[model samples]
Target chain A: MALWRVPLDAEQIDVTLGIVHIIKERCKGCGYCIEFCPKEVLEFSKEFNQKGYHPPRVKKPDDCVNCHYCEIICPEFAIYSIEAEQEQANP
Target chain B: MTIAQEAIREATSHPLDDLLRTERIPHIWCPGCGIGTAFSSCLIAMKESGIDLEKTVMVSGIGCSGRGAGYVKLDSYHTTHGRAIPFATGMKLANTDLNVVVFSGDGDLFAIGGNHFIHAARRNVDITVVCVNNFNYGMTGGQAAATTPHLAKTTTTPLGNPESPFNLPLLAYAAGASYVARWTTLHARDLTTAIQEALANPGFSFVEVLAPCPINYGRRNKEKPLDTLRLFQDKSIIKNNAHPTELDVDWEKGVVLGTFVNNPRPCSTDMYDKTCRLEEKPEKKTAA
Candidate 1:
């Protein structure tokens, strides 16, 4: 349950730090992750994966507010958010 | 920090991964299909139900949606076409302790499996049936199914379906389902809650999930996946206790969606045990 909610406010408050993990192999090029993204941070890549599906890429990584709608809507489970920080920031 | 960021920062693990058979991923469903959304909602429901995962079993009939059983990391059976209900019934009656769930597509459940459906609901079998209604035979190249709307063009109905379709919710309600509801993939939260309620229910429970079959049903019907979802958003009216008969699905008239019925009744097992007496077996005392 906790994982389901991506906490949009948390991402909005901090603008400098955001990362995303895109497992290109797992992607089926549904474009759902790009289409349903509320933050408009994703776009279909010009390059195709091994499976010939155009996996999504983070076009505006800074604009990502961690809404997780992309993750939720992605049927392939290929794209996900990854929050990163410098050492000694939150550790 | 955002939860996603925090997770990456902390290097924590996800809780839901164990629920899925990751090795079998890159699922066969086409891009923009709604079956994945519906399946994910059902997974959320099962996780939230707090039931014993080990004792739970998933049974699926042959169809694109039937692949749900194979994808879930649980005790599952991918049975022959249109027999998921009977297989699940046998499992439930034999153990009486297992939680059996039947997940399949409209073609498998209502067309080839329609007879089993009525009998199961009539007897009030204790099982949760999730029917993903894509309005056609999605896996087999989108043929007109029992639930396909009139005037829709399918592979088999290229001239447009002259016959009317079955009203799933009305049928289930009339057949004596204890909990019956209809929701689209767009209504994930509501659908999840409805599925949880259905799983908790004691008697025959039915949930009809209206999904988009973009490649087959949509391409021919002149609708994109997102367009179908938007239609659901714009036209869907939530009438929680609406009469089943009045809830016919006609996009022109707006679609009625909600938990149409939620009445608990004694399940078949209870009635059978009460009516028939069984001789008590002696306890084994060998090598004591």
Candidate 2:
């Protein structure tokens, strides 16, 4: 497929973004998320999912811009992003 | 402990999860089939259109593409073969508030459902149609259909298809579709944009999506899944508002893709209501 990074302008980027959740079994191993990630933050894991497909793994989590291109291009809807929880200050 | 492990901790959540029939996941479509992409584009369009999901209904006829109705978590109907248009038309006329969309294949739309296609456009039915054209009957083992290109090899045309394929954009434009466009599965953004526009249009709007049937159509023609996509990327030229007559798909040369028609016209419902009002007023005075 033609993998193009869809730029989302006018959207706030969550600087404290933690992780992109990947539903292992649901990933069809299309690699669309990895190919379309503008940050080059993802790679295919050596371990296979239940379907024997290699789901994407976060290679550089801190580089993520919180863009939803990976989530949108996932034909199986297996991947999504979430912001990290704030660290509690000392009492 | 690891980033991969952390990411896989929870099932990925998406806004479209509720919009899909998840139980039908790992859908029946073969790997690399373009229907999923086309269907996703439609869902994105519907979501972006800001239409009331509760008041929208998707109607589809029998084909590989027809399976879309079953997958979309909407008031969708997998109607009889080649009847998606008429079924959606009835839904629209029964409740004008509902946004009726007909999603089906080229064989279902232009072969058996062809008469309905012409009549629906001629009547200016208020509906959006997404026709996924894979060039052959994928469901029925790749038989040659009305849209199969001339000299293409299909199961039904073992030597070569001697018949000329219908120029779909021209056909739809000539048939009186108010908004007409064609896109490939490779052009997801363009397809989604056109679909969004078609959904918002007032009268009959048709969007033809050229998709890949990698298993049935591709293997027979020596095109693997990615190779099929390469064809689309290499051969497509976008020309918005180009005349339909110039938008023919020639595999050797290239295919022109664009939103060819977007002129608004009075829909059937609007005309019917106006005619009824005129006759009702005249008949009341005569009776009095």
Candidate 3:
């Protein structure tokens, strides 16, 4: 919904919801996912993983569109997204 | 387990786990190195190419990128430095049905294995070569490599590299590659697509991937990993089917990326079977 002008049929189209998952232990804290994410949904967390590098956290979880850009861009296979359940999408 | 813990466990299990060596979780790549992205793209392409995984092989040469063979859950070969292509060629010839993919670094391919690369391409070998060009000898303390750009700083070339870099796409095209393409690590989606296309090509296919050597090449050049990624985003232009001659790595003038050549030629195996095997079969039949 980060559009300049809402589409006329926006309400009719069911937007696919996504749940961003971050595996803190595997992350190297490269920040590629944070930088390239189209939705700007992730941000660096203050807490560090075992490697002492800060991993990303979902800032606006609802904004994720299941594009999987973060998953593909993540140098570490530490993050991924699965489509949210129907109940979570409605909620 | 609590629901939250169960969810966390499920989330941590990646889709690529089946394709990767699970025991090798947490690869040795640096925080900002681009090889991981390139390697993952290759894995995705291999999965999506719909090829027979049982008969597929991954080969690597000695380098940071060469560690790829160790991480994959496939029949892989970790060959000697600069010999990945030759080994892959042998595999393809011996087992024509096997899908051979040579994944190695620019230094390993173009520096020590340059002759093998040209010869393989010239013969139109039925194999796919993915070269990750990080612009320096990363595993060897950031030394200047054959793909190091002019005036780039490296441990060996502190004052800046004096020699020009090779235009890999042009080299592959001139050597008779049936398909050639170039993509930076930032273009992960396109890179995967190109790899898939290269996988499907019948003859020699070369894909040159531009990756960031933040620890090695970038440290001397004063470009951080993020800065290099930003440059890749702002400076690269997509020109599909562009002449191979125009495909050079010029960061200042913008980098050209896309599939440059894709015309099929009779591959080496087919030619050999047609000329050599055809004659031998007739002689064997007459003797019988």
Span of ten consecutive residues with least summed lDDT in model 2 chain B: B279-288
DockQ of 1: 0.23
- Interface RMSD to the true structure, each candidate: 4.1, 2.6, 1.8
Task: Identify the leading candidate in terms of DockQ.
Answer: 3
TM-scores of all predicted structures: 0.85, 0.86, 0.92
Instruction: List the candidate 1 regions with Cα displacement exceeding 4 Å.
Output: A1-21, A59-67, A80-91, B1-15, B278-288
User: Across residues B16-61, which tens digit of lDDT does each residue of candidate 3 receive?
Assistant: 8898997898988898999999998999999999999999999999
Candidate 2 regions exceeding 4 Å error are: A1-20, A31-43, A58-70, A80-91, B1-5, B8-10, B279-288
Comparing 1 with 3 on TM-score, the higher-scoring candidate is 3
Residue pairs in collision within model 3: none
Report lDDT (Cα) of residue A42, candidate 1: 81
Q: Which DockQ-derived CAPRI band holds candidate 1? A: incorrect
DockQ score for candidate 2:
0.35
- lDDT-based ranking, best first? 3, 2, 1
What CAPRI grade goes to candidate 3?
A: medium
* Model 3 agreement with the true structure over A1-91: per-residue lDDT tens digits: 1332577997898878778888888989999999888789889989989999999988887788887888887878888887778435553
Please give the lDDT score for candidate 1.
0.83
User: Best to worst by DockQ, what's the order?
Assistant: 3, 2, 1
Fraction of the reference Cα-Cα interface contacts (below 8 Å) that each candidate reproduces: 0.22, 0.31, 0.62
The TM-score obtained by model 1 is: 0.85
Candidate numbers, best TM-score first, in rank order = 3, 2, 1
